[model samples]
Target: MLRMLKKMDGVILFVLLLLMVMSVFTVYSAIQSDPKLGNHHIKTLQFYGIGFVALIGIGLVNYKLYIQYAFYIYGFGIVLLILVNFIGGTINNANGWIKINDYLSFQPAELFKMILILFLAHVLVKRKNSTLHFWKDIVPIGLWTFVPFALVMIQNDLGNALGYIVILVAVLWIGNIKLSHALIALAIVGVTFFGFVKAYTSYHDEIFTFLEKANREHWAERIDPWLVPDKATSKASWHTKNAGLAIGSGGITGKGYMQGTSVQSGRVPYTYSDSIFVVIAEEFGFVGGSVLLLMYFILIHRMVLIALQCRDRAGPVVIVGIIGMLLYQVFENIGAFLGLMPLTGITLPFISYGGTSLLINMACIGLVMSIKLYGQEDEDELLMGEQRPTLLERLWSMVKKEKTTA
Candidate 1:
């Protein structure tokens, strides 16, 4: 166990600790400004305490065992997702959380993020590193991914719903998608998005009326603020507009910690949760924001390096999926505040004050650490001529064998 603990990545550990510090400090500042947040900073510390425990426990386990049981895990996550639709309560605009009790509820959509990666990695490993055939490989994978995507969308959780798409695309790319198929997909997505924008801008009133009649006007509320700002009502565009104002007010050095007028005034919504970036920016300014971003960059860079060094094919596949998810979450969250992307209410990853978000993200680190710990060949397997399979290897062979992997 001590030897396994030695395998943990020191760089990643330090960065998580740093992010934990940042999260706690930011949450404290947010609560000071927004009374409704009430001691979330204390809760943030407790969540981090639990997150580290999860990270260590998960890291000690062999990730191959996870891939081996990927199907069962995927089915379980899907079951919870389906169950939420029947018995869950709504939070904000999304109805994706299942209440375990009065104080602890979880979003299966978040849980599915990790499960999807494991299952997709397992599915792709069966292809043996060859270029994926569209119908046989890519299509089926898309259909598998579509199951959760469609389910999350039904819950009105657009942010988590879109995250599934991000994961599927990233995993497929690493799974060796064909370049021609990739190009075609790129073209189709581009044209579809462009056409969507065109149709919405051209027929704003008609689209708004249709959405209103369908009781899905919230969709228009989010889109109009981004697409046609002029047409968006004060109520519809209030969040984005206010977030923009708060961030812009935080010039070079910022208004100083706990001194953000906009944030303290509560003009920005969800400041403790989704809009935490606004607090960092308002309090610490561009410099503070850049520092946090640098930490994220370094953390991802370290993971990429670990993936590159991994001997097992599955290690890199899983790491790439994780990378894609983290990148998308950070981009969408901060970008929404800057108006570079539409508001999706996606948390700012480690820095955001969501229990489920923090726990899942920490577990992702543990997954990466597990790969780092178990995915490489040891000295006995390398220097010695022939050696017995280690315990992890024994468990792996029990599941399935893959010639393409290390």
Candidate 2:
């Protein structure tokens, strides 16, 4: 246990702590004028407490164990998702959550993100770092990813659904996907997206009416602001419009903490949850948002270093998949509010206030930490090639050396 604790990455842990501070404060400010949210800042602290336990506890375990049973874990995840489809209650119009009595309901889709990462890595690692075969390797991976993607979409959770493809593309890239195959897939996706947007705008009413009849009108609400803001109803565009205005209002320095006019006045909804980025932007300005992103950059940079330094093939594959999961969530969450993308249920990775999302993300980091601790066959290999010290190893070595000198 002490050994695993010693292996923990100090830089990443420190960044998580900083984010916890930011999440708690921002959630507090976001809920100040909204009475229903009710002490979400306190709840944020409690969730972080549990999340730290998950982080360190999972980090202490060998990550390879996850890969070993990846299929079974995936089966379990599928069971949960399927179960939710039947017994799950709706939240925010998405019937993707299962209730555990009144005070404890969880989202299966959130947990499945990590499961699919492990499962996909397990599949990719079987190629032994060789070029993946088009039919045998690539097709199987796509099928596996698509199954969960379809399931999540069935529940109307577009944010989590998009994540499966992102994870698939990432693992395939690292898994030695053929350049020719990659280019073809890329072209298909580009054409599909462009055509969808053009069609969506051209036949707005026709498509929206179809969606409305199918009980998915919210889909139209999400896309209209991004694709054709001019045509979006005030009701459909209000969230992104006010969010953008509030963010722009912050200027360089911001309106001061907890002083966001739009936020306190209830112009933007979900500020305490998915729109939490608005609070940080409105209260602290571009400087604050930049600082938060800088921390995220450092966190990702450190994990990428860990992946690059790992001696095991599977170690890097798992890390890459996890990286994809996180990068998509962070980018999409912030992008939706900026009107650069359609709104979805995705939220800022660590800075958002949700028990399930925060804990699952912390566990993903734990999986990364596990790779750093156990992925190597020996301590000597912890250094990056030959004798060059990795950033993690150098920082850790200095800390230990200072203790020895003392």
Candidate 3:
């Protein structure tokens, strides 16, 4: 156990601890002004304890075991998603949560993020050396991605559906897809997105009418405010407007801890969850937010380093999928907070006050840690073998010999 602890990625563990500590402090501040949510920070702390255990426990297990059981994990996630559609309760007008009781409910979509990554890594590693064909290679992977994506969309959780898409794209990028084929697909998506935007801007009224007829008025409501700033004062745009204001108000140093007027006044909805970034920005200002961003930068950088060092295809592929998940969440959450993108309700990974997201993210980190600890052994042997060393290996050996001589 002690040896394993020494082998763990210290940088990642530190970042996770820092984020959890910040979560407790920020959540406390965000909830202090509200009588009803006074104890929410306590729950956040409890979740942190649970997340810590999950992180270490999952890290101790061999990640190959997970790859072996990838299908079962993916199927279980699908079952949970299907169960939510049938018997789940609604929160924030989205039927994505499954209530186990009055006090306990979880968003299965969060768990699905990790499961999808595992499944993709398994499939991609299996087909790593196979010939890439649009029909034979890509379609099966697309079908795997589409199932959970369609299920999540059915639950009206567009933000998480987008997350699934990000994971798929990331895996496919490293999954041996042909460069020209990937470029062609990206070009098609780009053109389609531009065409949709042009049509919407040119004929918004017609688009709105069609959306209303199609029972997607909620999407229209979200799009309208982005299209016309004048409409931002509407109920649908209330959260975005307030979030932007809170972030802008904290210019440099901020108003100080627990001193945010918008947060105290309850103007920004979901301050402890989706809008937690607003709370941190409003209280700690741009400096604090930048510090948090720097932490994430280090975390992602370490993960990428591990991916590069991994000797096996599955290890690196899994890390890429995780990187995709974290990157998309950070970008989408902060973009929505700044009104640069539509409000997606995606929580900031560790800093947000959600048990499910926090736990799942920690588990993903645990998987990365497992790869770091176990995956490097084989590579180290190869590096120090009796064969003629490459330039890089010779340099590495010299460094090691110097340290030993010292």
Give TM-scores for every candidate, taking all chains together and pairing residue i with residue i: 0.93, 0.92, 0.90
lDDT of 3 by residue, 75-168 (tens): 9999999999998888875789988777778999999999999998777766645656888878888999999999998887889999999999
Separate clash counts for every candidate: 0, 0, 0
Tally clashes: model 3.
Answer: 0
Give the alpha carbon lDDT tens digit for every residue of 1-406 in model 1. Answer: 9998887999999999999999998888787755666889999999999999999999999888788778999999999999999998999878999898978888899989999999999888777678999998999999999999999999999999899999999998888999999999999999999999999999999999998997778989988888899999999899999989989999988999889998888888888899999999988899999999999999999999999998866888899999999999999999988878888889998999999999999999999999898879642332222344778989888666654453
Off by over 4 Å in 2: 378-406
By TM-score, how accurate is candidate 2?
A: 0.92
lDDT, residue 122, candidate 1:
81
**lDDT (Cα, tens digit) per residue for candidate 2, span 227-301:** 988888999999999999999999998999989999999899999889989989999999999999999999999
Q: Candidates sorted by lDDT, descending order?
A: 1, 2, 3
RMSD of 3: 8.4
The residue pairs in collision within model 2 are none
The whole-model C-alpha lDDT of candidate 2 against the native structure comes to 0.89
Q: Rate residue 21 of model 1 by lDDT.
A: 94
Off by over 4 Å in 3: 213-215, 231-233, 377-406
Candidate 2 C-alpha RMSD relative to the actual structure: 8.2
